[model samples]
Target: MRRLLNDLKIMLLANFWLIPVIALLVGALFYFVAPPPPMHAKMATGAATGGYHAFAERLRDELAKEGFTLELVESRGSLDNLGKLLAGDVGLALVQSGQELTLSERQRGDLFGLGVMYREPVWLFVRTPVTFQRLSDLADLRLAIGSDGSGTQAVIGALLAANRIEEGAYPENWQRIGGSRAANALIAGELDAAFFLGPAENALIQRLAAEPELRLESLNRTRAYLARLPYLSAMEVGEGMLNMPMDTPAKDIVTLGPVATLVANEDFHSSLTPLILEAARKVLENGSLLDPPDSYPAAPPRSLQTLDEAEYYYNKGLPILQRYLPFRIASLADRYIILAIPLLVLLFPLFKAIGPLYQWRIRARIYRWYKHLREIDLQLYKGEWPDDLDAEIERLEQLESEMGRIEVPLSYSNELYQLHVHLRYMIERLRTAQKRRQA
Candidate 1:
């Protein structure tokens, strides 16, 4: 151990600059290859009672169980959620599907989805029976199209515009009250029709579905809607799906809806993706409204593209390392696992070459004294040995003393011993020559 350390000391002293340079290189590697995982993250959710908000709370609680804190910031709706994510107010948010496709290249580059958490069916409730087969029939009636910035308003607005209803043929017909309020207004004879974009579990949605006077519109133009709005899909609610006991709806109701996707800033912490996704699985997998069991958390959401992690997760599922280890450690391992390959390539050669280089350095020191010894031996053989015999003896004695104090690693001790033997032999030859000259 001591000998090995001595060799390392000598090698490093001879090439001391490498220490800091390598340290700097390692630091840069860690900086680029192994960023620390975020301890906490914030998500921009919707109104307190909205589906997005509820999903966020469940996610927060799930993450908290694993010692991670997820803060939920309430916003108006999907539009507001998108705004917060872009402005960097939060790391993630629940956005209505399809809105992300409207962003510019720069905006798209800044955002990505984890996956579609669940489908949010766009529901149209009418007090009267489906007298009209189209959305145009409800134009003259008093309607609530949800809050101004809500996904319900955005989708309904598009449908209204396509049907030429937004051309101001009926200016006083619509109101901007949100889901719970709209449900109440419809029951009180204030609203003839209303739209809500959420799961059936919402109290307002549940009550509206159970209302005897009100009827749910199937939006018979669902195919045409999907043709124009690729983000939405045709959805069907089964007869007993809402309330099995009440057999709410009494029949299947076809509708149009955009699924709700869990989106995040592109720079959001990579480690949290799978963790939140797994948590989403627990909450959204039971399905909602129109979805069947295990129907949600779909990869490559219909509207926006997803992070590559989501692609990997969907295709391959969670990493094996994450399955065996804690999330933080596993994430760190995954981050640097690629880095570890290159680092190993770098360090293996350096470590393999070190011992030889160190030995060469040790040999160089011994070679210096050997060079002087060679010159002295040649001089002693060529001339009358007694002329500078005393001086030569003194020179040999000094060489021996100097060599005694010299150090090398124990592995090279054999070479050092050979050097001592040569010195002693030279001294003896010099004395023999002196005696012969005197005789």
Candidate 2:
């Protein structure tokens, strides 16, 4: 053990460069092999009082329970949300369904849909009772353009343009209120008409519905609009949907539009994919927001955000675990599997090389005694008592004692024991030769 330690010390001192090299290699391997730091997901929420913000907060709370940190960055609306997502300012965003957005290849590369949350009905409120046949009728009237870069503005802008309602022909009265403020402005008679894109049960939408003076204008041209734009679907706001202050019920109100979607970067980590899906399942599939049971896609729509594994399973009507178990388990198993490969690669060569080298070292030690014995036998044949005869016997005894201490595997133990026995025989022969000389 002392000799082995001395050899190791000498080698280390001579090859100091090896110590740092080994450390750097180990550090680099550890960096690569270790799991990445937990993601701090940034989401672009809408104005504080908007459904986008409310839904984002709900997602944040749900994700928090599962050990994830979600940062909600409030923006104007879905248009701003998409802009943030495309600019890499956020990882996730809430986008309205029928927004007219043209993404460049670079922008498109950064974004993808997780799934639709819920449909946002386009509620157009007009103060005066007029035969509102089409969206073109509001072209010359005072209209709320919604907050700049909002989903409401995006959808209304597209609808007006498609209907050939040129901006030059429209009234000069345009307001930029968003969320609950937009509802407040319309109720206060500050605006002629307001467009709100939110859930039927939204506080602002309900407030407006309860107002006796205000009327919910049915874009009776809903089906025509839907036929023109495939993304938009006509939804009905049922009778008594909103309770009035006077106990009056709002009758069947026909509305138009599409749902809000949860979107993420295309390169989002796959580990986070399940968490997003789980949250969506809790909110949309479990009927947290909607009233009627099972009103969603009987079969998944072939649209944006429907490409996810979880969504695919949801459409197929299977449990989350059944569809996702293999993927989840594979992610976990990869860590251990990665470690095993390198260890096996290193050990195979070490075992192969070290076994033969160790055998050679042991046999060489035993052969040294044979060489000394041969020289002693030559001296005995000369009929001379060499001055070093006693010293040679002592040396042979010491070598035999050293061999007795050697340990090897049980299979190699026999070879070690044989080497010790041969050394003992050589020592006895030398002693015998010495005794004969003395006699």
Candidate 3:
């Protein structure tokens, strides 16, 4: 055991040069690897009570679990959210699917889609006892299309345009007020009907659904609208889908509307794509009335180009490391993995050289003694002998004893023994010369 310990000590001393070399390589790895993704980001959402804002709040909570802070920026609606992304005010935003049609070609180039979060159905609620067979039938009555610069207004304008009802030809009875104000007006008998855009599970939508005097109307021309407006999807709302107790719709309803899509700008980090999307997926795991379970955070009906990372996430779930590790740690591991191949290539040759280098170092300790032996043999060959021949012989014997205490691994024992033989031969030659001088 003691010999084993001594051998280990010698081996460690021999390879001390590797310490600095390994440190240098590790430093290079850190210098070249990209920094970890940002731990915080800004998101643009709609009014405080709106569905976009509500979804953003849920997303913020989910990301917080992974130690990521999500700052939510309040805006008017989808158009406002889109504007924020274009102005570079926020890294990400929730936008209605068709709102991109309002963007110019240049503006469109600045944005990219992550995925759709959920469906935003177009709900048209009118005062009861005033039934309309078609949208044109209620043209003469008081109407609140939607607020200015809101997604509701955008969708309403498209619907009117498809029906050939140009804005210039709009009736004087049509109003631009929307949201709680519109719902209030329709309840107070001030307006005949109002258009709202949001998920059926939205608080505002649920409130309006439970209203006794207001009636939720279906878009009978859904097929025609979908054909003309490709971005709109046909949604089937079964009886009592919104509220099982109140039986909100009273019967089956078919509506055509746009989806709420998660959009990102060029400034948003691509590496954060999977993290955000996965959080969103978790948020919508239990689908709403119109959306099936695990049906959302899907990859279509986007106006701008889809992010490559987002596409990868949709095709295959979260990256392997991200699934098991915390997001920050996982992201770090991911970056290291990208550079691992080159790092390994560099270390391979370095590690391979250790064996040969160590061998040279151990052999050097035994070879240095040969210098003293060579000097003695040269003096005798020149016929020049020392006066204290016996004392010289005694010193050589002491050297041989000292050499026995030096140790090398078993594999190099042959070299050590050969060293012993050479030392003995030199001592014998010195003794012979001393005896010849005495005779």
Candidate 4:
């Protein structure tokens, strides 16, 4: 035991920097790579008058109740939101579905899906008497592709380019406007047609439907768009869907577009999954302004965030675990039970073996010295004589004196004492041999 301690002390002194270096590496890895607890997440929302901004404020309030702060950063629209998310300027954002995703290789690492939030219907208001039946029919007409770098612009531009409607092929009236302004422009004859994608209750859509001169274009080419782009779903806006103080649409209007999705970085903590799921449940499970009752987990869905454990639970009708155990116990068990198996498998054996292994190592060192003394004694018994018998006696004496000062456990005390006895006998034999040689 004492020899082991002495060796440990020497090793510590010789390699003192090893422990500090390991500690520093561990600290650095934990600080930079490990996911943080539920924290203040920066979110890039849409323009103040837009639906994205409203959704962001509501989400922020919900997350605040769970000890998280959501900082809302206003952006132009979905395109700008995606840009900020890709740039690492924000942790979360709202992105429109069905838009072709074009990411640089570096930016692809930063992107991941959370889940679909709500659908944004592409409300196409065009002038009456045009008799537009298909998307290609409006190729030569003046159409608003929405403001630059907006979600609407990206979707509309891609759809148009797909049908070979190049920049100059259209009437060349592109208005940079959004919300009510864009709607009013179409109504006032400034724009022949305009596109709006927002909540159903948006005032601009209501006002446009009331105008007798304008008509909502129904793209009966739903099957064609769906065949080409699976993400685009046809939504039915029934008569009287919107009310301008009880003034409603005269007939049913069908539109096609993608849903907006709530997205986060891929490395978003698994622990925060429950909290995010809870927040999503509060906002999404029940019907909102757009979705009817229980119409969520939307069909033919699109999302920037990938499904995880909490999302799976939300989808499966959040069953209560407390029914199987006491409430208090269940809560504690759920939080810590995942760690128990690994701890038992790895640490339990290590702890059980450490004490006995340490004792065995110490005893082995003591037994080795005793073996050397026993060999010398056996040589004398065999009548083997050497000229240096006196020197061998001195060496045995020194070894015995050193062994006497060693500290050993009570269990090994007998073995240590036996070594001392053997050393003494060896010394006596060596002395007798010397005396006989002298005679």
Question: Ten-residue segment with the worst summed lDDT in candidate 3?
Answer: 300-309
Off by over 4 Å in 1: 1-25, 31-34, 128-132, 362-366, 384-387, 398-413, 436-439
lDDT (tens digit, per residue) of candidate 3 on 175-249: 998888998888889998999999888898899888888888888988899989999999998888877777778
- Per-structure clash totals for the candidates: 0, 0, 0, 5
Each model's TM-score? 0.86, 0.74, 0.86, 0.64
Return the clash pairs for model 3, or none. Answer: none
Please name the candidate that would achieve the greatest lDDT relative to the true structure: 3
> Which window of 10 residues has the lowest lDDT sum in candidate 1?
162-171
lDDT of 2: 0.68
Cα deviation at 427, candidate 2, in Å, is 3.7
Candidate 3 global TM-score: 0.86
The C-alpha stretches of model 4 lying farther than 4 A from their native spots are 1-36, 104-106, 127-131, 136-142, 187-189, 210-214, 244-247, 297-341, 344-439
**lDDT for model 4, on a 0 to 1 scale?**
0.68
Q: How close is candidate 4 to the true structure, as a TM-score?
A: 0.64
Ranked by TM-score, the better of candidates 2 and 3 is: 3
Worst 10 residues of 2 by lDDT: 296-305
